[model samples]
Target: QQQVKQSPQSLIVQKGGISIINCAYENTAFDYFPWYQQFPGKGPALLIAIRPDVSEKKEGRFTISFNKSAKQFSLHIMDSQPGDSATYFCAASWNTGNQFYFGTGTSLTVIP
Candidate 1:
């Protein structure tokens, strides 16, 4: 079963604009939420993340807004650039963090 649901299978953003991706999960047991960015042949890399206790987390141009009550979370890319083009995935994990339930994926294209 798909534990995590992600929307907007694809996205296009203008340079300097903001790009957003959303995800939802039903399992309240999940304690960790992480967004990943993947390019062509590379493995997905951790972008930014937020815990259930945190409403939001920001790292440079990347931010993750979490809604624990709604069982939802979103990733926001600020000042999006062409270099940011990649496939983004939202995942949820429990305390162990070994097993992760991932969303389908969202391909983002940042155009100049």
Candidate 2:
């Protein structure tokens, strides 16, 4: 029940376009949801997040839409740029583990 699977393993989009990725989880007990963005040879950093208590959350160019009923969520990158080209990961975890179940990793290329 500790898993979050993401899709499109990789994505190529034009600059100033929208980038979308989806993820789902099996554990209903998970309470905290976070999306991470990582650059080459770097650890993933918290991009944005939402809790089961909310339906969606947004921060600047990044947005996270959560569906509590479906146990699913997605990340949307608005105005994607070449600088945004990197690996993105979707993750889930409870407050207990300090460890998160991560997606296989999505390598995004924003074409200039």
Candidate 3:
């Protein structure tokens, strides 16, 4: 079963706007949460990550909001640009072994 669940499936935003994607997980054992961004023909790469110890994390314009008690998390792209358009995925792992769970993914398009 998919331990992580994502919503909206897709998104469209104007230039300089904000893009948001949400994800939820049912596993309390998941200690690592990471968001990935993938461009066409390329493998997904880590964009941002957080541990349960952190409520939020940010890297440049990308921010990850984590709710430990609620078992949920979200990614927010501020001042989104056309170059920010890509496929985003949320994943959860125990930070050990090879066990990991990924969300369905959300396609983002930033219109010029």
Candidate 4:
């Protein structure tokens, strides 16, 4: 079963703009929410994350907003640039690094 659903299969944003990607999950047991950014020919890297205890978490230009009650979350990329163009995915796990449920993915393109 698809536990997580992502929106905007693809996105195009102007340089220096904000890029937003959203995701929703069905499992209430998921406690860790992490967003991954992947470039062509590269493995997805942890971009940012938030736990159910926090409503939001920010690191550099990447931020994650989480809602426990709604079982939803979103990623916000501020000051988006061409280099930021990549595939973004949202995932949920039990924090054991055993398994994760991922979204389909969102292709983001930032053009100048």
Q: What lDDT would candidate 4 get against the real structure?
A: 0.93
Off by over 4 Å in 3: none
> Candidate 1, residue 59: CA error in Å?
0.4
Residue range 6-106, candidate 2, lDDT tens digits: 98899999999999999999988888888889998898888898888999899999989999999999999999999999999998888866788888889
lDDT of 4 by residue, 1-112 (tens): 8999998899999999999999999988899989999999999999988889999999999989988888899999999999999999999998576598899999999999
TM-score on alpha carbons, each prediction: 0.97, 0.94, 0.96, 0.97
Report every candidate's CA lDDT.
Answer: 0.95, 0.90, 0.94, 0.93
Candidate 1: deviation at residue 73, Å?
0.2
Judged by lDDT, which candidate is best?
Answer: 1
TM-score: the better of candidates 1 and 4: 1
Residue 92 lDDT in model 4? Answer: 93
* lDDT, residue 95, model 3: 61
Provide the RMSD of all predictions against the true structure, rounded to 1 decimal: 0.7, 1.4, 0.9, 0.8
Candidate 1: deviation at residue 82, Å?
0.2
